[model samples]
Target: MFWSAEADTSAVLLAQMPVVLPAAANLYSALREPAAREDEDGTHFLFEAGGQTIRIARLAGVPPEIPLAAFVPLDADGFDRMEGIGRLLRALQGRTIPDDHRLTPQQKRRHRHMLQATDGRMNGATYRDIAGVIFGVDRVASEHWKTSALRDATTALVKDGLAMIAGGYRMLLRHRRRS
Candidate 1:
């Protein structure tokens, strides 16, 4: 149902937005049943047919700032050789797709910690108090706690947790490419 003069642009836009064409959804449903790989960038949906390798990458971009569903072709030659490019394109147009916002286990854990820390702060706990609760009172009371590794680590964790809550958590969600 989607129409585009340019294939690459269409692919990128479809991947970036939550709009789903039945075609694209069906394509993803059919494709993701195979084993996928995870890396620093994102999850890669790969398969082979017609003697060519095809790869569809769901890239995780910085959250809040970027859309979570951005998908792209990893293999240019293979993509060009893909048998159903036209069908995929039509599927990417017109309709809306459900958002896949499930967070990873690590992200879920971090989110909980972040929420707890933020709640503590909102309830009148100081940075030192927060550190005490998180790193142990003995460590917080140490002479070097304020200027040492524990303090730095606590600060970093708080900042990262806050950022994730603010928006970064969106990146943790899997895009709507169902297996």
Candidate 2:
């Protein structure tokens, strides 16, 4: 694919992005079945918890950048309350993520970079402190350019087994304990 000169690259630029949104909120995926949790109805309950904007669209193969777009100007909490879109988004939240899972070399490096940049702490950082370096921005970023990071990060984490629906089924990241 070729880059568009007039395109809003900053809106989709991952490196220059911020981390403050749910790292795992994304496009349509099957809602989680209750197993590890008690009587969890995943999506249905997630939207009700209410705090983000959510929506759905068809895709043969959506670029990682597209979902990141959702984060900007419309974080999950914005859509989480919408009548039509919220249902679709809530249904698409990913299930549990594992702790021991490894990240892609690039992602691993990014995580390291974040740790270093923040000096391994998030005193003033929003998502960074709360979600750690990787998830901190991913959970709270609803700006245009950062949306893809939110989408891709969440999807990657879930696929690699690093996140989960908390007891309340709000998108909760697999938090790392500080040493």
Judging by TM-score against the true structure, name the best candidate.
1
Every model's TM-score: 0.37, 0.17
Name the runs in model 1 displaced over 4 angstroms.
1-111, 174-179
Q: What are the per-residue Cα lDDT tens digits for candidate 1 across 1-179?
A: 22121332222322444545333433343343267555555545543443333345555452223333434446532333232344343344423333223456775676676776777777887767877887789977875755778777666677777786687654442222233
* Residue 87 in model 1: lDDT: 35
Candidate 2, overall lDDT?
0.32
Clashing pairs in 1: 1-90, 2-93, 15-70, 21-91, 24-91
TM-score of 1: 0.37
Candidate 2, run of 10 with poorest lDDT:
8-17
RMSD to truth, every model: 14.9, 21.7
**Residue 66 alpha-carbon offset, candidate 1, angstroms:** 35
